[model samples]
Target: MNSPLTIGVFDSGFGGLTVLRALLPLIPGARYLYLGDTARLPYGSKSRETIARYALSSGRFLLEQGAEHLVVACNTATALALEDLKADLPIPVTGVIAPGAAAAQAVGAAGHVLVLATTATVQSGAYTRALEARGLAATEKACPLLVPLVEEGWLEATPETIAVTAEVLRIYLAEAMAEAPQATSLLLGCTHYPLLKPLIEETLRRLDYPLRLIDSADATAQAVAGQIGTRAAVGVATSTAFYATDSIEKFQRLGSRFLGQVLPPVSLIDLGG
Candidate 1:
């Protein structure tokens, strides 16, 4: 490619910044347009029809901003509206679920695999279907507390907070491992989870559970790079423009944590419900 590609990434909130963080080093030449539908978040509690509608609205907004490809960064949106976005949008569309399962398979994850995700994602069973479709058995566990803990910066905070986070992870992993004793890999089913990878690995080590960790954010970035057929271009720095439906200040603060870098000015755009 002679010039950089324009890619659109959509998510319900700050978590999707992890996907963008993974994309930067992999495809350093691409221009990214990220939209966080902050106003109508918690898509988890919404109906499937509503989620598809919201996701389609976000995708269309990104397309209008000159996006050539779309990445559905939110697990809930990916599970519920991926097909809808693919059908309605003209450009290539990728979601978090398939790439994650494919990553597990790529790493020689055979037999059973354990998945840690949000309650809504677990209820949707998207990871299980994706893994099973790839001939790998999957057990999904919902760690509803993990997302909030990560968002609150409990990871590597005060000793008390970190200990609480670790204990929660230990409990979740203990139950998940007991359910899938044969699991050789553990898929991090939420974008927010990549931030907790070290702790997760530590907990696994403590439990003597040797499940390889798979981060969907990394997997999805690799998938996007493959779809575009280009990689990091030397001397070609990547650029990103951030947009959010509500709370630009908060998005900048929390999003910086997920992206591992300070965010630029976030333009506020209203996408009505």
Candidate 2:
């Protein structure tokens, strides 16, 4: 393949932009198409069948836009619907969970590993399964509030928002620490969590929880780079496109926070219920 690659990234909402942000630096030569299924988000509340149906539709839509490779950036989708998408989507696909678990194993070295993710992702026990496969002991806590706070742009907002977010993290991490007393690493199992890494690390310090933080978004981007070697020409501009199933206005407004740059105009596309 002499030409640049076109990779499609899908998420339930804006959090996936963290994955795309990580990808830009690692694989900048390639074109990127990101779709956030905003209409039917919070996939954690849905059943497995519903998740698979929604994810399949998004994957097919990306392929329709000429995506040669795919990245499943949403933790809930990766936990519940990855296999379904893999079986049906022909492109080489990667997800955040496996790389995240592997990252834990590599860093934890048999020490207890703790994961902070969405309620649906934790319920699926995907991280537990992946970590255990590598002979690592794992504890997962569903900090359901983290995703919402991240999406709301509260991480760096006003004093009240900052304090509230910090308090929430303190509560979740404290509870998780009590359960996984020996846990030595904290995997930011949600893509959005990466944005709060500094706050999380500070909170861990305050609580004396000596766990290294690993952002799965970064891990996934590294995996993608390994699979698709650096191919950007020395001086060619990269192409990026954004789409959402609902609320294009919100996607563009909140998405800039995830992408670290003003998002290009995001087009609205329906993937159906």
Candidate 3:
């Protein structure tokens, strides 16, 4: 591995920016290439074949950009196409689910863990199986509404909107806790959920639950950094390139929230529908 590693992070949409955000601080000065397949997003609803097709295309594009390592930031892609990617690409490929599960295990929590993700991810049972592999039981809930709400910028901290988001969290958490009362850790299964971490913590606080929160994006980033094994900032500056399959303006606008900083002009990439 080089001092400034060239890593490619791919997601179906902007949610994966959180993973990149975590990576920026951990691997500063590293050149990063990110692709968001906005045109064929919601990989969750698509079939495994369609998802593998779309994800593999994105992975190949990143490799063409000279990426030495690939990070599949989308959980759906990790669930359905991770092996496909590793088999097709020569680079070391990593996905979010395994690292997320490993993080929960590292915390050494007793009882079960709760996973919150998209319907597709929950249906895939990837997180459930990963956690079970580490000797933990998990209950997964698909929080379908949270993704759209986060993209809509509904978390403006205004009383009304805040209440709405919190209420939604309350409802989801209440239901999830009821089904798995022994769950001591809450694994945020979606990359987008990191944006709602505060609200989720507050909601649980109000609910009188002391569940440990795990952000998959953070866990994935840590795993990637550990794989590279460089903590010291080595280079002068970090470089990043952004590509999106559709709606460059929307991706650039909303992506900043997940990236934790403003994004440079995004290149419009057409990965054929």
The local distance difference test score of each candidate is: 0.91, 0.90, 0.92
Q: Name the TM-score of candidate 3.
A: 0.96
| Tens digits of per-residue lDDT for model 3, 1-273 | 345678999999999999999998888878899999999988989999999999999999999999989999999999999999999999999999999999999998685899999999999999999999999999999999898889888887477887888888899999999999989999999999999999998899999999999999999999999997764336458899999999999999999878988999999988897
Expressed as tens digits, the lDDT of each residue in 56-166 for candidate 2 is 999999999999999999999999999999999889989999998887777754567899998889999999999889998889999989888888878888999999999
TM-score of 1: 0.96
Model 3 pairs whose backbones collide: none
lDDT minimum window of 10 residues, candidate 3? 228-237
**What residue runs in model 1 are displaced by over 4 Å at the alpha carbon?**
1-3, 231-236
Query: Over 4 Å off in model 2, which ranges?
Result: 233-235
RMSD of candidates 1 onward, in order: 1.7, 1.3, 1.7
Number of the top-ranking candidate, with lDDT as the measure:
3
Clashes of 3: 0
Model 3 CA deviation exceeding 4 Å by range: 1-3, 231-234
Residue-pair clash count for candidate 1 = 0
Identify the candidate with maximal TM-score: 2
Ranking by TM-score: 2, 3, 1
Candidate 2 achieves a global lDDT of: 0.90
Q: Estimate each model's TM-score.
A: 0.96, 0.97, 0.96
| Cα error, candidate 2, residue 35 (Å) | 0.3
